[model samples]
Target: MTADISTPSRALDTDSTLPADAAAPASVTFADLGLPATILRAVTDLGFTIPSAIQEKAIPALVSGRDITGVAQTGTGKTAAFGLPMLAALDPSLRRVQALVLTPTRELAMQVAEAIETFAAHVDGLQVVAVYGGSPYQPQQRALRAGAQVVVGTPGRVMDHLERGSLVLDDIRYLVLDEADEMLRMGFAEDVEKIFGQAPTKRQVALFSATMPPQIRRVAAQHLNDPVEIAVTRQSSTVTSVRQTYAVVPFRHKTGALARILATSDADAAIVFTRTRGAAEEVGSALVERGVSAATISGDVAQKDREKIVERLRSGALDVLVATDVAARGLDVDRIGLVVNFDLPGEPEAYVHRIGRTGRAGRTGEAMSFVTPQERGRLRSIERTIRATLEEVEIPSPADVSAHKVRSLLTQVAARQEAGRLSMYQGLVREYVTEHGIDPIELAAALAALAVGDDGPRAREEQERFEAEREQARAARRTADVRGPRREGDRPERSRGVRRDAAGTRYRLSVGHTHGAQPGGIVGALTNEAGLNGSDVGKIDIFPSFSLVDILAPLDADAMDRISRARVAGKPLRIKLDEGAPVSRARTARPTGDRPRGAHGPAGRHDERRTERREWAPRDGAERKPRHRTA
Candidate 1:
């Protein structure tokens, strides 16, 4: 494949009248780019049917073995744009390094190496080595000595190898500088130049950058000869489908607050971003402590561990991931529904990139930021950069968290019921109740409360504190909203309630573990469908076969109708009561047929006498009901 390296279009305005290069005609496929059959087969296996814009334009130029300069965004699949052709152009028979790709950070280098390996999987006998700082270099040196055809490394370590004369690029035929602009920003321009000087002048050179700065272009002119230039434009300032939200969380409570938020969010998979590698580990550990399956990725993580973590995230083995900016580079997970910023991003560009992890490939996503009072200015800066306002969300209250958990439990129960495995549990329940002389309702309530961690004092205290803080935050936000810019018709709409019930109606749903239902999903579905805020929802009881949700009584008939028809986890909820009847009747019904045959015969006289005796029993009474026997 050859790039159309036409002469420059116009001369410089100055005396240096250098003609600008003409753009090349767009190619459509990897086949058009002349990729080897082996690489094409690998692409097909990877499920990439057609070439991306970068791939179509860059592959041809790269395969032609010409010096190329590409300007593209991070998520445009630039790694493969150069990687495929480089692998195809490799001389597998040769023992020495034939290609060298330098990245600004170790994470990017590892990513490039992994990508190259994936593309070259079918190309037998291809050895690709990734070398970076902060680890033993002997292993890398050994791999190089044994024969590595391609070397992907960070500039600092690559320079170290060059200085030590451990790496020989004299035989190198291709050189790639990925994220060229970032390398320059990191003060690696001098090192890049020095490294480029070491490679053969006649070698094929490729420089890929997200942005075209004067410095990057100068490097291109100095190193690349008659290079083919390709620029890929961003589709939009912000991904339209991503729901951007932020919370003003204090720095000290940010980690705890993030855990709570994640606990309450309807996220399948999430990425938590931190400014530093250490913070990634810290936040990841915190989440793990809170019983979330989590992993950390950063520039410092071993290549093997990073790959494993990425694999886990992709396979849904891990639900939450904490990563630094550089560590998350080249990650392309389709199931990542949420991206969180534990620390406010220092640059608006970084924020864009962080949030861009979600809302990928036309899929809807969410990006949430935790901003401290001091970082309010930073939040404004981010808003200005994205040219949009981020909706301020109140931190979820303890009640909200509890409700989410209950819904999750109920969803799990529904799933279990759908699986038709409730007979075993039913048997266990009957036997337990018979042996203990316990009321089934009381036993079920205890079990449900236990499952959702609804212990007495601690749970109440936590809920109270969370509610207080949430109310304070909401008040602050309402005040700010009143003062901030408002649309012409931004007045609050009057809400009408049809009735007010002293006690809410308890409606059941057909969702549980069998349906892969989570508490957050149920809450989200109800909140969205009912148009009632999370706060309006009450107690949630998750049984093995189903889940029960509390709705305000004097309920909006229209809302209830909508909820009954609504689909949760693709299943329409019966939305009635435990007895499979309307909520109104169930609320007033008394339990029948279930009375102990013992001391309380058919009549309720013995039970009433026992209750009276127990109530009259003094603290000093010698005979007392055993703690476990007082049903």
Candidate 2:
């Protein structure tokens, strides 16, 4: 059935129209949708009882060989909606690439590929290959040459394979664009168009996006023939059972802030969402160091390893899973009681999807987002989209963390006591009291301190120190805000501020103006990777080829290594001590202005590039410098 596809600028109501619910009944199952037994068995094994709104509407049309454009949000069973139908129609005996699914990110590609593999499990000889960047190309090339019937990948990597002749679409009968709008947003429009050109003209196409922007609609009009248009709109974007809140945190203190939040939260399990894969690794590692049982999942993580991590989360062996948005797609874990947005999502749709990970199956959940002062606007957009105003909350302080930890330990002790396993420990404690002639209460208190690793005064000192650094970071940001953006003329002013601290150490970074490196991005990279506060970072000089920054002296080898590996403007810092040259002066111009408009081109015209990563962490031995926070 044909339908009028409406765009914001125009409408195509001349064609026939079909009701979205025409085929879907109040009770519709996979069997009712005419899915083959092979696909049905996998669906049943996945424990899916009924189809989702989009799946109910789109499955029949797709399986019937009709091109379709679907409007549905992420996490609404979009994968199964398209995947099951595609699998039902594919020829397993044909070992060529019969189908290609293009996604916006590597994480999404990996997720879609895995889901399709599960759906095609009962269909023998049906091989699915996932290819994306940030991984070795040799393995992907080998997989492509192995006669895989289905290939799922990001547009950039797919183009790379096409140019290299490793992947051929001559026999492609099915082409799907998942999250089409996101691909366009990430500047993959050109790559996507080129892929469309390479695919066979007779292929059946399916395009699904959360929103139908003008560009996407235009593409559909130009390519899709008398297509079926299906839209699944939600009355509300957020789950009512999820208690949502926001915390205002400086970027440099987010890691510490997140640690405190997790320590205090009563959630059975948590998922921390970061915007970039690098941030996921960094945050996951930092959480482990801070004694949180956390693991990371991203595009870079292998599919088999991701399954293991999810299993750990399900079996209660892991308390937290740090992931990028695309990495966590289709991840279902009933115990996820909390979802923390370490970095506010760029899109409100993503915010909804992130929080949806929790509050599932009628269970109440909690979602907390960490927002820098500059991100207050984005936070408002999210509220508008979710149709709920999130209550503002405070990050737990060091004292709060300590108290929570103690409470948790005491609860464990109570459980151990109830289990009646304390006889040996009690006897030992009694002997110690008798030998020392100490009060039983005093001895017990001492043992409890030892058990909890409370080093008396030193523990108090450490807590106080952390609190001080946190406050210092806040104050530095406030001062920077009042002073406004720094200029080349402000270098001397910055120099005076640096000299006030213990002699700062100068470090050089490989990224500079030529790499689109800006001071705010550099500071963010350092604070996030090195776990240093904004206050701890020093003067930044953006030269043409390389930049120099002053940091607190005597950084440990581990911190230095992290800093060296930190990335800014899509390039590693490769940071080192700036002892090579006595530069006369720093660059006079600010690098924060808009890039040459036509040079890199506008938002939609540029080639796909990695979005700049934003985050922070904490470290020691850095002298306080003037600090600034970017939105």
lDDT of 2 at 436: 87
Q: What lDDT does model 2 reach?
A: 0.71
TM of each candidate vs. truth:
0.52, 0.61
Show pairs that collide, candidate 2. Answer: 528-616, 531-617, 531-618, 531-619, 552-623
- For model 1, residues 501-522, the per-residue Cα lDDT tens digits are 2224556677643554445445
Over all chains combined, what TM-score does candidate 1 have? 0.52
Instruction: Estimate the TM-score for candidate 2.
Output: 0.61
The local distance difference test score of each candidate is 0.67, 0.71
Error of 1 at 38 (Å): 2.1
